[model samples]
Target: MKRRLVRKLLFGAAFICLLSTQAFAQDGYRMWLSYDLIENPDKLSEYREMINYVSIPLSSPTLEAAGEELTPGLSGLLGEDIATTNQMQNGTIVVGTPGTSDLIAGLSLDDELNQLGPEGYFIEHRVVDGNHLMIIASNEEIGVLYGVFAFLRQLQTLQDLEGLSLKSSPKVEFRVVNHWDNLDRLVERGYAGLSLWDWGSLPHYEDPRYVDYARINASVGINATAINNVNADPKILTDQFLTKVAALADVFRPYGIQTFLSVSFNSPVDIGGLETADPLNPDVADWWESKVDEIYEKIPDFGGFLVKADSEGQPGPHGYGRTHAEGANMLADALAPHDGIVFWRAFVYDPAQTDRFREAYDEFVPLDGQFADNVILQVKNGPIDFQPREPFSPLFGAMEETNTMIELQVTQEYFGFDLHLAYMGPLFTEALTSDTYAKGEGSTVARVVDGSLFGYEHTGMAGVINPGSDRNWTGHPFVQSSWYSFGRLAWDHTLTAEEIAEEWIQMTYSTDEEFIEPVKEMMMMSRDAGVNYRMPIGLTHLYAQGHHYGPAPWTADLPRPDWTAVYYHKADENGVGFDRTATGSNAVDQYQEPVASRFRDLNRISDDYLLWFHHVSWDYEMNTGRPLWNELVHKYYSGVEQVREMQNLWNRTEGLIGSQRFEEVKSLLEIQERDAIHWRNACILYFQSVNNLPIPNGYEAPDHTLDYYKALEHTKYVPDPWYN
Candidate 1:
């Protein structure tokens, strides 16, 4: 059954009431798209004067979507129903492509439109033939739809529209969201509810929620999405599942989103009954070619494959002694025919390597130029797994000959899951704005992924996001901010984290300064707070085994050496950090000059990454003039305090934001405080045991002993193996 119908039947008339109250209730289901009536009479009057009628001179499905969204959205914000007109009027907001609209064609905007490419758009307030017209013009219908959303955003954020002139084009070509969802409805690392895709009912009963999903993504300029776990199951490629995927593609297509799939590299053997799945094998290549053809027949605008080959246990070309280039090129060849691209993940690691941080760089740097033009190596933001804090991946700018895309995890896999309000805007901007020093000082990671630094053919940014069956999409109300910020930054990297947060706060919640200022500060400080509590002072990977939530600093019983906490921390009597300088792993040398020199120099390095690049003694003096041990304790305690401050900040806005969401956030902040304390106590005690350091003179002693914290079961916070 369709989930929406099931919801209606189960709830009856109460569901209808819920929909009516949604705007005021702040259920979070509407995310930032909620269009509440403007309370300021003057602002509402101005908006009404500017947008009396929405005039779209086109008839395409995309242009129709623009009209559908604009008319109702304006009506809600202006507190009056907006009319649609076929003729040009003084108060009309005209939106369309030049070819579709004679009014747009007559504007002689050929030079301006030429620069917008396919997905770019412009919104201008101009006096055309003595009529004040708000013109939203683009080169294509989808771009017009984007412009419609952009125009609404100005009203939603309460921006002054007196002399508005805005033009935007995505810095990256492919802005995508990758859902690590499985066929059985279980989401890997997903704290939100079940997978959004109801495979059981799909290909027959379409869900209305799918349209909303596409709308939300399109609202933030996300143009593509991969619909399954990268640890792909071969059945997704079969005829039975292709039909279901096609149904989803149809829903996403009208919103300018192309659907991609995560393909198992062993599909030739697992599903096709072949002897081997080697990329070099003729039969294996032919099997992929046939499968590509079959998929195109189902989804003509399919965005192609996202492969996790040769990583973690997924099968790849390595079994046949073929390089990554060989494997990627083989699939790229099949996809290139249909203008599809291959997103080959460069998240590989070898157990034999002394440092896991150097594994991806070592493996892929040599074969950078060999991969096909259609293949993009999707590298993680950090070289290590998504730890709370780590240096930018050395691979970001190292592969000068490759087309690279940054893959950032929006789900809080290593950042306290759904419990902690760890906003990721700062985290994303930190990585993007980091100086790679590849082509000199201005060569940022953002430039590399956006195809400017290396001048590569393909460029993109993919977020590993969680939007599941939960009413709010993501479990924590704040997670929507990360997903929103990621899409905005992916569209244009120049936008600041603070700018996006303020916009999100104004749109999603209340626009009053009492609510916006404090809430924005909390979101901006959230990521740093998470890092301070869990892995402060460049410490990382101290989470419990398998589940990766809560602390387990002494855990060393894992099967692989690299899988244990001891491998990353290297805590001992002498000190408590892994050494990655010349004397140790030499990972700093991987970065270009100046950046390498700064990281290697103890005095020059930021204390934020002191322990990341060098192992310092407990008694060693820090930039704060305190011992390293004292500084460590200070950061851990400060993190818990920050959460408390966040709670206070949120409490001030009570009765300002709707009571429903205010209470929800209030309750989550309490849980977050408890979790923060747990992390602080467990981590500090465990490290103190190794260093034998006393708590700094002014600090309060730990509530529990090291053994007490260690003896606490994993279930004290979250259950092991998220599937349960």
Candidate 2:
């Protein structure tokens, strides 16, 4: 009889969801948090029966928020109102922190909860006196909040609730989202729209999107957010802005997201009216300490500060002849008193006689154990800015004694703004899964950042967020997958790209097999396609100067050679590709043992990284046994074919999803096809001009002249992002 009633309610929810399909179905404002009704009857029946009654008394704002989400998610899935009663009933779902409820404390789950840390939780099915119940217990209120979201995600993603045993702990200690938003509500490299923070009405009027942003992040186990751009302004450090930031802290605190800020390193001089902002100076240190104290007094739970010192023209202690460690440690000392950390970026570069790719490793490796315990060096995924395909930054395992955090760009600044549908999951997976060879063979980049390899004091992974004021959160609808993918991989790096893609697709779009299978294939292949057209065969940093939208392989006019395309491609009369071998930059020597030796050899390395470490002749043989020129031609043309294939595959989703989204994506596919052909033509024509070779037979010919591709104007492009 219980099974019958559960089945009836399960099917009823599906019926209601089908009827309410018009309820804001097209706009993607509600991201992966879309808890649509469960249509699968057998799985839904099991879940409905397991989640009948919920008992989570209001303990704190955090617990109240978690309990508030439970009823709506249950009602939306079961197609009926779930009652919250004082009395326990059959099939009750009890959720609470250990100290808040006697029923949970009696279970004595402290041992299990203690192992998972303060932010982890477990949901188990328990039986007492012939009554079966689902118990969600955690050691802290924040852990209970995470437990609630994880339980709801199972229903949202259509997972079976029978014999449900969910126990999860975030692998990385600090999973943060970094927003490149400015005080003027203008975002750099942001394609979605203007900034989400309304600075004009900030301290008083709060936006609803702020809470929703925290909700989506909490669902994915994200714990912190650096809410401003790293290229910060001194005005943001004033007391006026602290009150404005405190308002956002109030909204995010209940969701377990502690707010952080990007601070100007010269704040002592710029805001505090100091004569010198040297890290070693006593007056400078006192000013910073007082400012940090004031910040914590206003917002006690403030996470910390993210400083992009001495990178891309940002101010730093270098002006006063101080090392990066001295600068970082001084700020770390101030924040350490409040249990706060300082994320000092390792993206510094100069126009010295050195390879730009080897700069970060060179600067930070020697100062391995110099930083304070509370300081984490934030290194980009690649040594360079977020290129399409570059080797993992050698800084990962090089600094064993220093706490390191891997920083990733999810905003598609170089991958092509809203025009391209490139999923960043594969890129993130390739970097994380690469063998660092720090200690031995199994020492992956994941191990270094997760504090397992050298057992560091802190561990973190921060992604530069792609979100803006667009209705879909991210500009392109499919771009949301990258944001979701980053959060999942940060929580647990073992998750595969295929799993993340499937999970995101099932939540964002329809769960129909026909719709899922094809879209998943298209999503997984999107990254390689962009790489082929933009920067294939280990090529990096070949885009136009400012916007980075169009192809400009001939760009040689820039303030610095490292900022130009020719510096990366090295396309001269003799040959192409930068030589980073022992004969050249010797940057490959930074990696440990066999890993470095493998990259140094051409025959042993994969075709994906052939040109990265070595410069070969135009007639050199590749794995296909074809000459280098022939293979280069094929790879460039293959990129266009992939995009065309993606367009045809997307056409299959015409009737599966809403026409508004379907048509919007289809139009972007058209733009992508045009852009891919332009890239193939522009790059091949320029390389052919240098190699003095003809277009290989059976590939599309360039319609425009080489001079025409070079002459296209990109100097006046808007939004020059300070990628510090």
Clashing pairs in 2: none
lDDT of 1 by residue, 553-651 (tens): 898967788888888889888897889899999999999989999999999999988888888899889999989999999999999999999999999
Q: In model 2, which range of ten residues has the least summed lDDT?
A: 715-724
List the candidates' TM-scores in order: 0.97, 0.95
| Candidate 2 to truth, TM | 0.95
User: With candidate 1 superimposed using the best TM-score fit, by how many Å does residue 445's alpha carbon deviate from the native?
Assistant: 0.5
Per-candidate local distance difference test: 0.88, 0.85
Q: Per-residue lDDT for 345 in model 2?
A: 94
Regions more than 4 Å wrong, model 2? 1-23, 713-724
Tell me the spans in candidate 1 whose CA falls farther than 4 Å from its real position. Answer: 1-19, 22-25, 719-724
Which candidate achieves the best TM-score against the true structure?
Answer: 1
